[model samples]
Target: MLKPEDFRRSIVHEPGEFLAILERRLRAAGSSGRAGPRARLLEKLSTCYQLVDGELSKAEAFLKKIVEQGGFYAELFKLEAGVEPGEVLKRVKALRRAAGNIYASSRSELKSARGERDAREAFRAGVGRLVSIYRRNRKTLSAVRRVALEFSRMPDVEGDLRVIIAGMPQAGKSTLISRLTNAKPEIGFYPFTTKNIIAGHLPVEPYGRIVLIDTPGILDRPMRERNPVEHRAVLAVKHLADALLFLIDPSPGKYYSLDEQLNVYRTVQNMLQGKPLKIVLNKADATPPGELEEACERVRREAGVEPLVISALTGLNLDALKNWLTGLLKTGTRGF
Candidate 1:
């Protein structure tokens, strides 16, 4: 048998199951994702996956690639929906147009801010109002961006990322999210605590400036089913997030055991649809160093991705995680 370490180092591609499913569905529908609704939907899904998986940096690449592929995804989407993705296509085009506007406007405003427009109290007030303006005009703001990131695009109404944090209810999600960011999802030792999505921002000094998002935790099914709140959190991540933070604890049932929480990991592994993914090994403080290392090795062998080993309670490795995540901001390439 392949040793855990051996498997960990092996080069296995992260299977694009989600994309394949969408492709297959499109084929069944006989539409193919050809530059229409089918195409736009696939692009949207790919962008969403990138955001949820802590891989937003890769999103534009995926979009650009799809576009270059001459509407492969568009055909696929059309194939799946069995309808002209005309409406979806229009929305996508409009979103792209809006992205250009935001960038242009930001450049002008950013320049004014630097050129003394910011010297006056009015400018200061304007800057202060950006957040609220962002909150109030969030729908329009999100409307301009191709990929969803901030709260403006969030379902139900305009809100912040704290909305996402409150949604994660797993044992360590709140603790970790609150510790790393300001969203504060109500930390607790017990399960089923966070009943909604709480969002927070991780300050980044990337070179000098950047932003990282901390999302709610996700525990696999079964236990999640036991708590209706958790199920909603999972669904919300699927629908709203640009990426996901999936946490697994083997002995999560008791909190101190070393059981390899394969169930939750497996559940997410299958549901993942070419989305960028981040695996988190929370409670690293609770386990022995060697045990945590071994657990990580085992997961790497199976999951084929590196994990963020952390102790939310003591803040161990949290800084590193934040820095690492901040490096994945996809701001400049927003519209592709």
Candidate 2:
């Protein structure tokens, strides 16, 4: 997993603001040193070049990691930023290279200068060129900051077993994960409350850890028609889920019809591609027994899989669901 916390903590400032701070540091360093005027000027110029190179190098390294990791970070940058991580990395590297070339050319000129004045002029010109490069790529630098901040908000899923709880709007997926694990996702009586991937953990002794992910509500639509929130669920199902728990709301007040929910299920099933999928019928407490049985029969007839009935609200048959999860995970067998 590409942990967002691994990103650099250095605050990326606006180019002008960064230059101002660097000038202040140079002034203070010069005032505190006991060197001649020419020596002080050259020393500050050297320090300025090093500072610019270091900052650009750090940003380039972080962007490279995001590209190389190519898991959640890469997908997220592509989906949200509308650009690939590698593309952004290229821009950063270009800025660094431009600055490095300026500094190298200036250093060569300084070595061949006839006097201190010429050397000072060349060094100052190089410093100004580096600052120009930084200022010209303000948008690129801001993108680095935006990526770091966005990734910081991502959920952490550092567990052994990764299970995605997926379903239509108001399907009680969030409620069920909250009931089963310590994660308390924002629950509401509406659609699409989970706009991002929320993770909950349950440790099963020596058997290892189980990570339950609650995904945003997915409507039955084409991938191009899906919103960013729904697309995030699709991405998680594709990349992160080791197993899936598809929750179906069969109550009278369900948001989407059984046919619609099944359509979404088929999409997720395609993403799973034979991964372990546990179909769970939620809101059993609110549903009539006859209607619930009919829904179960419908699911079995259409999806060709039996579903476990449980009420996420009233904790009906929840213990059984937990036991099944633990047993199946422990033995690598699929049965209730």
Candidate 3:
């Protein structure tokens, strides 16, 4: 499974640096044939081969993810190739084959060699072949490196219930996510505080986990006006959200007017295509009593659903919200 931390470590560089790192790891993996029985040496050799296979397999998986789930990266790949999604797969296969050839050659040499010295020589030859393959496929490896880095910026969310916290800039989505889950997304007062999707998890007993995603703050404007990062956020809402908490700012100094916020909500609602959603009136603590009432009435009249009122900053009514969500999960309502 892809965990949040995987994003930090998944990017593999070009074959040159990658091979060097693998070589160091292999050397530190201990002598496969250190002054032991022949069987022991063979066992070590097998383990080493498995290690190489495993690492290459992981690299291949990363490439596949870039091609499949990297969003903009996948689009770029398609535009560059003018083909379907199999180009990266082809490159991954070629890289795997090169690594496999080294392992096969090394295993064969070890089987035929007479002594420990010869076995060690065979292993050295295998590492040399790995370096040679990397150098020969420098171009492909370079492309892989670039794609890996590009894709690493996108968050990987995993859980039973995927809940997206989305709203206009400064809508308290980040604060609410931090309060509801274990993720501490950067909290800022400025617009576009969050430029990418940030993921967190809420563990509810007997109901498994809920993956909470804090998406980038989107403006109340046409989709064409949004940047690529905001576009990715919209795509996440469309594709990843099993449920959504669409936050509406009702504060007097809110960046966008209540009507503009509602328009953005409608845009997201349309994008979601009937996925479960909760229209949350955030910043309730700061909103005036009359203004909050007006906003509530307007939301109900406009959306035909009563908006949930809560102050994410003050933790007001948050427990009740949690209980309500828990009930939804238990009943499997709204396809939770």
Which candidate has the top score in lDDT? 2
Please list the C-alpha lDDT of all candidates, in the order they appear: 0.44, 0.84, 0.75
Tens digits of per-residue lDDT, candidate 1, 1-336, equal: 111232122111122433354345434442445564433333433333322222212333333333344332333323333333344344444544444444344434444453343423332332233223234433332322322221122223122221122212344766776676565456566655554445555544433222223333444446425443444445544444434566655332444333335555565545445545577787776777777788788778877888778777888887786655554442321111
Give TM per candidate. Answer: 0.44, 0.90, 0.70
Task: Report how far off residue 200 is in candidate 3 (Å).
Answer: 2.6
Give the runs in model 3 whose Cα sits over 4 Å from its true position. Answer: 4-10, 15-58, 65-85, 94-143, 146-156, 333-336
Between candidates 1 and 3, which one is better according to lDDT?
Answer: 3
The digit string of per-residue lDDT tens for model 3 on 100-208 reads 8777777788778888788778766766675565577666555655555655665667677788889988999999999998998999979988877799888899887
Question: TM-score winner among the candidates?
Answer: 2
| Candidate 3: clashing pairs of residues | none
Name the TM-score of candidate 1.
0.44
Candidate 2 ranges with C-alpha deviation above 4 Å: 8-11, 14-17, 108-123, 332-336
Candidate 2 lDDT over 53-144, as tens digits, reads: 77787678777888888977688778877788798888878887887788788877776778888978987887788787778888877777
* Residue 109, model 1, lDDT: 49
Considering summed lDDT, which 10 consecutive residues are worst modelled in model 2?
327-336
